[model samples]
Target: MTTGAPTPTYPARPRRSRLRTFLPLGVAAWLVLEIWLLTVVADATSGLVVFLLLLGGLVLGSVVVKRAGRRAFQALNEALQRGGTPESGGGNGLMMLGGLLIMLPGLVSDALGLILLIPPVQKTLSRYAERTVDRKLRAASAGSFGDAFQQARIHRPDGKIVPGEVVRDQPGDEPQGPVPPLTR
Candidate 1:
């Protein structure tokens, strides 16, 4: 048989759908809002005041986000232990996103991102994420590609016909007499 590497038998994963496109757009919008807020806040306040406020916000946000992340992760772990798929927390990612927003020179993004980092908001977002993932998985599994095929060989010399299963003849079974022969 010709061989290098056998061609992959399984189908490739489908590309991301429209829903996947929404996530990045949403993040970008939030980033824009954050920058706007920062500009407004920085312009209204003195440098020292801005520094103090940002520092305090960072400290408070970190504590809250960290606790929330821990709790969410624990819940996910528990679900996995129970033989269930772990739910998305969304909090951890939001927290990081929030931190990034905060680092950018703007008050609006920081506020919005920090809000997202909160446990309750993150929990809701996480639930939404979980539902989305579940839907996609279900859809894929229900499709034809989900069904697998098996290959079998038939023991025919000419390869003109293939026999499948055979039903055994009983001990008392008799063969019919056949005197006629095929004529060319």
Candidate 2:
């Protein structure tokens, strides 16, 4: 029968997964690798060469985006005007993504972007995107709405998926009584 304030309780914190614990380490590793690459490039070539290459990538990426983005926007507009699917009427999104990647300050990203900017590579990517979207649409149309919702996966660091289910509680599921007192 003490008059002191009742001890408060809270839900236990969720356990951090192994991946979450090591995510910072992964980022640090990537930073170290990038630094090493930059150092090697500077040593083999020259600091000035590295600077020039980075500058060239940035400028070229900007120019590519400017030209392609305008055409994409115009095509998209025209498609919309004609009441057609806007999917085919624009620049390859992957190419634009590559251009954006090139704009980032890394030689690896620049090289990847340059590869993406290639016509054959862009075409291949575009075809792959179309096939993927078509497959997704086909699946969505063939399955129940819940099937689409269940596509989300939670994977462990060991590459195993955590099993779970979607639970929908009824509207009238409020607890009938909550008069039990807390006890130590």
Candidate 3:
């Protein structure tokens, strides 16, 4: 046998997605901006006012999230009883997101949250998001995770793919209003 060195083999590292690479940096920048803005507001007015504003936002966001969650649940129940997949929500999910943003401790987030609560804005955002996800899923390679997402769609009896979500109830949630009786 000839004496020769063999090349070592190693598993290739997976490429990082753009969102993964940049999200931390973006979050850091957002935190700095929010802190700076809070200080500016405190300097211009009073720290107590800022505190009150944040508290008010927290309460309002809580209310918004509760209402949206209730509505979404109701819609889901109605759809399940009808034995049909739920139509994409009428912005309740987006409203919940807005509420979450408002709950965050930042004026910028609060402003964005308030804007998202608007019906037109929510619809526009929802459409844009749908289009973007659809584009990404279509562009995904044959054997990738996106292909799994593509396969996860619910197809209608008439043979059109419809996106859907799987809902799970959290602990401590009590059923309110009339819950549909379970059938077959």
Candidate 4:
């Protein structure tokens, strides 16, 4: 049948991605693995062994927190004395996070928490967090930090101040007439 009107065609719906379908399966598999491993461990050693391990992990996590808390408080005090935020001193958050993870009733979290308690790993994580925060700020602020930082007198080296403004120049765009006069 021929008609002058065009045929009405509906847009195709998007298909569900493989990741969405497989993620739950992967999580289920991991949970099953953990259960099987725990069962084997329980059967091989007595339930007492599992209980001891959990108790030991809890004790260790508490010890780590007690030790780190002192250091964190010292750092926080020093930062306050120096007129800076407690967070600026670093390490406190990671240490606390590690302790929290260790406190969780899981071998995997305990292992990760132990790793995070390491000085080098804590420092690396702190730096990564700083970079991630900086990146988010930059992206959200639309390059304001970069532009302001560049022109900021406080950031100037050699103690010399220079005033400047950022001018955005886009390619393939003609200049819009002449620059307007500054108004008071």
Candidate 5:
């Protein structure tokens, strides 16, 4: 209890979130499973069959992605013609995601990608995603990303808030030339 010198204290390190801690491990396990499944399929059938399957998947995925892109572009154009902002994603994003998954090496990815391509599945997923986002936005506090645009205060990393507005230069002011480099 008796000390000649005062004790020094250090700041605690920020804790890692559960998702950050476990995601890598989960991905590694998934990769291992995919590779094992591929090997099993190859052994059951033939190497040529496996090669053909992969090639087919790549082609199908590309086609799906292209179709989704075209649809999204068309929707945007239509919205512009109507003189309004584009509405929510018309399952194009989900379709593209499915395509991306199909393009991946694993059978599980292909299956999931295929599932995403389905109209009903896409609708369900999109609705779920929208609801989740809405919930999160509603729950967000003043400092969260959702509330940043609504507030007038400028939030600083060190918790300082300065209220201000930009004062533009006069119309007659010429644009300043680039600053010269300082000589050593």
Candidate 6:
């Protein structure tokens, strides 16, 4: 019989996660809303007024984001200095994102961003972030597997019996050589 050709097997492609799809849609909606607001502002107010408002929003957002960023960095640094991993869940990136959202030409985004920039809210967010990180660390440490004997036996301060093998090697003895060695 003639040799048959091999069948081709294609590799499966990885699908994009829902978050990836939703984030772009959300950003696009925000942009469209901002454009609509800009048009409204242009129609209702003079160019000078729009410019002033934009400037004010930029300045306010910058100040808020900067202060939050500094606090977040300081907290992260302190944690790292104490031999712990820095908590970055609610870090400068989030604050910057909020500030940028505020800079969009819309009242709603600005208000939401302002709320996010508040110190009390940021502090609460940071505490929650820290706790989350702590929980993850604890879970990871707990989940890790070690040598069975490590857990099987633990020495007590008082001479008490624990259920496990204890092997002790003494330092003194030497065995005689060539003593009826091996039989096949």
- Note the Cα lDDT for every prediction shown: 0.68, 0.79, 0.89, 0.78, 0.88, 0.73
Per-residue lDDT tens digits of candidate 3, residues 68-110? 9999999999999999988985999899999999999989999
lDDT of 4 by residue, 1-184 (tens): 7668776575587998999989999977866765676677789998888788778888888887887789888988988999987767357778887988787666777888989988899888888888999999878788666676775644344445665567787998888899886332
TM-score of candidate 6 against the unseen true structure: 0.53
User: Each model's TM-score, in the order given?
Assistant: 0.44, 0.58, 0.69, 0.57, 0.75, 0.53
| lDDT score, candidate 5 | 0.88
TM-score of 1: 0.44
> In model 4, what is the error at residue 167, expressed in angstroms?
36
TM-score of 5: 0.75
Query: lDDT at 9 for candidate 1?
Result: 70
Lowest summed lDDT across 10 adjacent residues in model 6 is found at 175-184
Which of the predicted structures, 2 or 6, would earn the higher lDDT when compared with the native? 2
lDDT measured at residue 11 in model 4 versus the true structure, 0 to 100: 57
lDDT per residue for candidate 2 within 72-181, as digits (tens), equals 88888888999996767244577688888788777777888889888888888888888999999987699887765666666555445665676776998876687586
Residue 178 lDDT, candidate 6, scale 0-100: 52
Better of 2 and 5 by lDDT: 5
Candidate 4: worst-modelled 10 consecutive residues by lDDT: 151-160
Question: Which residue pairs in candidate 3 collide?
Answer: none
lDDT of 4: 0.78
Q: Which stretches of candidate 6 lie over 4 Å from their true place?
A: 1-5, 69-100, 104-106, 131-184
Q: Give the TM-score of candidate 2.
A: 0.58
* Clash pairs, model 5 backbone: none
Error of 5 at 45 (Å): 0.7
The TM-score ranking, best first, is 5, 3, 2, 4, 6, 1
Report how far off residue 159 is in candidate 3 (Å).
40
lDDT for residue 155 in candidate 6, whole number 0-100? 55
